[model samples]
Structure formats: C-alpha cells, structure tokens
Target: MSDIQPRRSYVPPAVRATSEWSWRLLLIVAGVLAAAVALQTVSEIVVPLAIAVLLAAMLAPITQRLARVMPAGAAAGLTVLGTILLVSGLFTLVGTQFSNGFSDLTTQVATGIEQVRDWVRTTFRITDSQFDAYFDQIKDSVGKSGNLGDTATAVGLTATHFVAGIFIALFSLFFFLYDGPHIWGWVTGLFPRAARARVASSGAIAWEQLSAFVRATIIVALVDAVGIASGAAILKVPFAFAIGVLVFILAFIPIVGALLSGSVAVLLALVAHGPGVALIMLAVVVGVQQLEAHVLQPFLLGRAVSVHPLAVILAIAAGSILAGIVGALTAVPLAAVVNAVGKHLFAGESKGEIEQELEENADKDPLARR
Candidate 1:
C-alpha cells in the first residue's frame, strides 16, 4: 500500500483577497477618509463633545470612588456642580479684577504711547511735515474704504457667528456629560462583533490617555499661573490678578500661548512702570517658562504620556491648518490619544513569536517550567 498524506485545506481567492495587504491598506484609507468627512461635518458638535468627554474622563475616577459611598448619579451630579462653582468663582474674581484694571490700563497705555512717540520725535528730529504726510496717507486710505453700513453689517454677522458657536458648544457639553458613555457604547455596538472588542479596547485606551493629558495640562497651567502671579505681585505689576488669570487660560495652548501672555504682561509692565520694569517682567517670564519646560513638565507630564516636542508642534500646526484656534486647542490631547493607542497596538505585535510561544507553553504547563 502507498503511503497517504492528508491534503491541506486551501483558502479560496475571495478569502485571501479579504486579508491581503492591498485590501487592508484600502480599508485603512477608507476609514480615515470617513473619519475626516465626519469630523468636518460635525466639527461644531465635536468640539464641545470632545471637551466634555475629556472633562468627564478626568472626573470619572473621583466620581466612581464617590459612587461607592453615594449613588453613581448623585456622584456625577455633585462633581458637575463642584466644577461649575469652581469655574464660576474663578471667572467672577477675574472679571472683577479686569473691570477695575481695564480703565486704568487703557489710560496708561495711551499716555505711554504718546510719551514714546514724543521721545522718538525729539531724539530722531522727525518733523511735523513727516507726521502730516503719514496721517494724510492714513486718511486717504480710510476715505477709500467701503460703506460704513457694510462694515457694521459685517461686524454684526461676526458677532452672531460667535454667539452661535458658544451656544452650540454649551448644548453639546450638556449632552456629553449626561449621556456620553451611553453614546460610546451605542457607537461600538454598530461595529461588527469581531471588531467590537478591538474598538472598545482602543476607545478605553484613548479615553485614559486623554484624561491624563487633561489633568497634566491643568496642573501645568495652574503652576504657570501661580508662578507668574507671584512674580507680578512682587514686581507690583498693575492688573496682576487679571494677568494671572489670562496666563492660566492661555497656558492651555502650550508654547505659543505662554509667549503671547508673557508679551502682554511685559507690555503692561512697560506702560505701568517703565522699560526697566518691562525688562524684569520679561526675564521673569523667561525663567518661569524655562522651569516649566525643564523641571515641572518632565516631572509631571513625562510619565503620563511621552509625546515628542516636534510631534506636539506639528500636531498644533495641523490643527491650526484644519480648524484654526479650535483646532490648535484640541490637537495635543487628540495626538496623545493617538500616540497611546498606537503604542499599545504596535508594541504587542512587535514581540518575537518565540517569546510568545514560550509564554503560551508556560501558561499551559506550570509544573513543566520547574
């Protein structure tokens, strides 16, 4: 009798095609395009939802812990209430300081500008004739402008758009806080059964990374605000409290925001005191920024998520390119989520098969290893 060997089962062309490299690439491209379209269509909806989700994730652990003692719904409600109160108090304080400072700031700035112009004219020997020519050109340009009614209409339209955006953001935040988790579950349910596990896992990882990023950012911003506020107070800078609040808010935008806030602070110092005070304020800003970048950031955010500086800069640029200010604001947290998920997925796949096999064998026979 001839020795017989069993025939191996073969995959049909269609089956192979589904798992081919080209097919995978096409699927990935399709998914990305779909995401881009959805993002564009729902950007106004997405911005506030994203913010609420990040806030919810950051507060979730606290709520969960409180839920063990109280009810989950009550815990969540209390958390939201506390957050509202905190924000309200901060805003009220900042507003009061801003109102007190604004009038004086405006007057001082005007006076300072005039003083500098006079000093320049005296030192540089610039004549009234030269100034007249400049003013004449400015007047001619203004005369050539469109109708004042049209300008007013444009301004009114811009104000309307701004108000509408704020309303949309607030509405979205309410739904996201109350029903975001349920919505996420519903979304995952739409995926195929085989892919649902992966989707859920990725979502959880992304949410966790986003929470970490938000918390880290808040800490950094608070530190910056406190540091700058202290410096301003010591230097007797006008609008110290208001400037601190502005720094706290602007610090959310990272490198660029810090520089802008610092510049404003320096300008204020220049107007309030003199160039010497302005230089000192500039040095203070530089010192605080250096400390934040080298010490505070590494200690606080380094372990939370390890994103490259270049990647962050690029992500901010891309966000600005796509959605302007809103895009820039949201970019880093999104990038952090992407980075965390990418690391988790690719890191597991990169391990050698022999190690995996050995691990599997060890699991199968605990006594065999000994």
Candidate 2:
C-alpha cells in the first residue's frame, strides 16, 4: 500500500487561458469600481484639485516665459491675475448679453407658446374647457411635486459649493504655477532611482501632449466661435455673441460639447429668428465641426495626443457617469496622459530612445521646443 499513485488534475490549455483571462478581467473591473468609488467619495477635493492641475498646465508656459524676464512671484501673480481678468471679462460679457436678451427671449417664448397652443387647438379641436383642465392638472402636479423653498435651498447650497471650489481652485493654481517644477521633481524623486528617468520622461511626454492639446483646442474653439458667431449674426440671432462664447467654452470638452452648445445656438436661433435662420445656423455648426474634425485637429494637434473619437466619447460618458461634469471636463486630458504614459512604458525603450522620440515630436511643432 506504500504508494497508491496520487492523481494529478490537469487543466486543458483553453481552460487555463480562460481562467487566466477571467481573473485579469475581474481584477480590472474591480479596480475601476474601486477608483470610481474613491473618486466619488472625495469629489469635493478631487474636482478642484483636478481643475487646478489643468489650469496650471495651460498657464505654466506663460508663467515660465514671464519668469524669464521677471521674478517668479511677479510672473505667477501676473499670470494668475491675467487669467482672472480674462475669465471675469468673459463672464461680464455673457451677463450683459443675457440681460440684454432676457426680456426679448421671454417675449418670444410666450409668443411661441401661444402659437403652439393655437396649432394644438386647431389640430385637435379641443375646447377651451379641456385646455383649462389640462393646465389645472399640470398646475396640480407641479404643486404636489415639491416646495419652492426646498428648490431654492438646493440652489443656494450648490452656489455655496461652487464658491468654495473656486477659492480652492485659485489657491491651488497659484502654488502649482509657482512651484510646479520643484513639486514635480519631488514627486518623481519618490520613485526608486532605477526607474526615475522613465517615470520623469513619461510625465514629460504626457505634459507635452497636454500642452499641445490645450493649445490646439483653444485655437479650434476660437475658430468655431468666430465661424458660428458670424453666421448667427448674419442670421440676426439674439445673443449671437453669447452663443458663440458658450460654444467656445464648451468646445474645450471636444466632440459632444460642440454638438450640445451648437444645438443650443440653433434652438435660440429658432426662437429668436425663425425656422429659416435656425436651419442655416444648424448647417453652419455642422460645417464648422466638419472642418474641425478634418482639418484643424490633425494639422494643429499633430498626433500628439490623438486618442480616437470613439475613445473620447466613451471616456466622457464614463467620466460623467462617475463624477458628473468635472469628470467629463477632465476625461480627455486624463485619457491623453494615460495614453502617453502607456506608450512611454510600452516597449523597453532606453533613455536615449525616449529622448530621441521626444525630440522628433517636438520638432513637429516649434512651440513645443520651449
């Protein structure tokens, strides 16, 4: 009885492979779920910090240039002040437009409502009593739904949160622009020395991609604004410039943003002008987007942070689902950084190879050199 042979259980190759893939897939899903939960849990802090990082990335170059000719403090202060002024001016402009348009917009909306009512009455042959009953039902439903005071309180709370986030963003932005290099070095230094170069190099690549994307986006957004605004103006749309500004701001979010903002513009055109102008405005929006998709992005961005359109859409959708608009705004940049970092680690490229690749990329855009 010394040794009844122990039976060996063998997994087929396909079964083994399936088991391996199953655990890996499960691990990835679990990681994503954990990250999403963590992000949601600390959204108050993370949103502002993420926004500050983006602002710092955009303004760092200007700060650096200004620093060359002035003290770091003065340079940073100037950059921050300049950004504040620019943002203030934009808000002020939009407010003025809104104030100027509000009364007319209300009037047009009322008239549109009347027209629709008239059409419905004619089409359906509904009596005044029936329409009145409908309105009463709607009023009853509204009254039953919730209290006005509660809605007001919710709005006030949101405003308070916004103000606090703004303060956080500004406070973080100043430090980021001023001590960014030192902070980055300190961060990378925390990694083991053996892999420091690769980490640093990868970060540099991500930064380069971010800067290029930002610059290209700004340029594309401006062109989109001008093109659409000009059309709106020609079509005699109310709040034309304001619509353009909204488009410019939203354009930073890429494909879906443009479509949404453009749709708003078109709707306003329909309300303020007419169906004809609205149709023309819609065409203008589509044309400009086409130009952006084909010509501007490829030419200006130059494959630096070229995530696919489908990837962009998916990232935005996922981000919005996870963290609302802040997530949406940060999604593309996060995607670009991830893509760059992955490429930087994709092959076992040496330091020289990485530097050479970066040099070649930089050569594609003269602005990238500095």
Give per-residue CA lDDT, model 1, range 63-181, as digits (tens). Answer: 65776798656766777778778888988998888788888878777876666567668989987789889889999999889899999999999677666766665555444444556
Error of 2 at 111 (Å): 3.7
Residue 83: error of model 1 in Å? 3.0
Worst 10-residue lDDT window for candidate 2 reads: 361-370
Q: Which segments of candidate 2 are over 4 A away from where they belong?
A: 112-150, 351-370
Model 1, clash count?
0
Query: What local lDDT does model 1 show for residue 296?
Result: 80
The ten-residue window of minimal lDDT in model 1 covers 361-370
Q: List lDDT for all candidates, in order.
A: 0.74, 0.83
Models, CA RMSD each: 9.9, 3.5
